[model samples]
Target: MNMMGSLVALLVALIWKPDFEEWRLGWDIKLFARIFSGIVISGMAFAVIVWCVDANGPVFVSMFRPVRLVVVVIVASLILQEPIYSGSIIGTVILVGGLYLVLWAKKKEMKSMSNPVETNRTDRNVV
Candidate 1:
């Protein structure tokens, strides 16, 4: 975080040679508070995502990507009053199909492991 912040600061310093007056945050407490709150909420959400990965395993995170697409479509159409394009519909179909394929493959893998020859005793945990 520090390194990224420093790199961004350096970039801005090089690109925009501003005076101290402009650099100051000023007395816009409401805007500052809203921005700070957003940062905190985002951090909390990220922490929750980490916990989900730890609990459900890493592959679980990938499952949510397609859902994000659905959310974007809904938010754009409803909130922004934007029209949904045919391309977005096609992409959603593709995403759903791909997710189904992955789930089917994972099921097949587990089913095959049911055979005595493939079974092995281990201390691995499963949910």
Candidate 2:
């Protein structure tokens, strides 16, 4: 997924080659600074997420990703002074519910793998 995202970004950059020469050095420096900062932040975020998943297990760490959306909404409301709507709360509830279902399924799968006899018995019962 990361590779695909990077590929898409590269394709966009290749298609839209902005003429940096048109901008003054001062403005170009700010643009470069913003871009570099974004790159560094994204890289660090990815690294931390990967390390967390690796150390704590994917299901445990992945659960936090959906919750981050709720945090984002709250922060935006406070920091950016954006209005929070009822629909946003409903959507967030749905997102959390869905994430819980997915994680539950993953846990079940892991449990089944750890108990091969249960899987085999279930397979026999299906037949």
Candidate 3:
């Protein structure tokens, strides 16, 4: 989705003002290194995410997406010196609640699967 949006924006830019000069940001070593670092980190992160998705199904892997929001709230407040918004707090709470629910449901499912079902419910009916 992100890549598709970026490509669409690039296409629009080409149609609006076709200028190859816009791509030529005078090559500074720092700028090149920064871009390189970002690509490397992004690639590594993507590889790890792919590996996780393969090892664990998408449902289990997807639950971690909300964790990024919690991290962002902290970093935004502390590093960026931004005020903590009520929306951020609310979102964090919801994310945490969702995580707990998913974990609980998964655990319950595992437990139910692990224990064998008793078809002889005549004995259980007495209780």
Best by lDDT: 3
Question: For model 3, how does the per-residue alpha-carbon lDDT over 1-127 read when each residue is reduced to its tens digit?
Answer: 8799889989998998798887666669977887987799889988988998898667777899889989999998999999998999999999999999997898888889899797865656675
Evaluation by lDDT, superior candidate among 2 and 3: 3
TM-score per candidate, in order?
0.59, 0.56, 0.70
Residue 19, candidate 3: alpha-carbon lDDT: 87
Estimate the TM-score for candidate 1.
0.59
TM-score of decoy 2: 0.56
Top-scoring candidate (TM-score):
3
Residue runs of model 3 more than 4 Å from their true location after superposition: 8-23, 121-127
In order, candidate lDDTs are 0.80, 0.82, 0.87
Q: How should the candidates be ordered by lDDT, best one leading? A: 3, 2, 1
Residue 76's lDDT in candidate 3: 88
lDDT of 2 at 41: 84
Q: What are the per-residue Cα lDDT tens digits for candidate 2 across 20-81?
A: 55434565678888788779988998899899888868776767777888889989999999
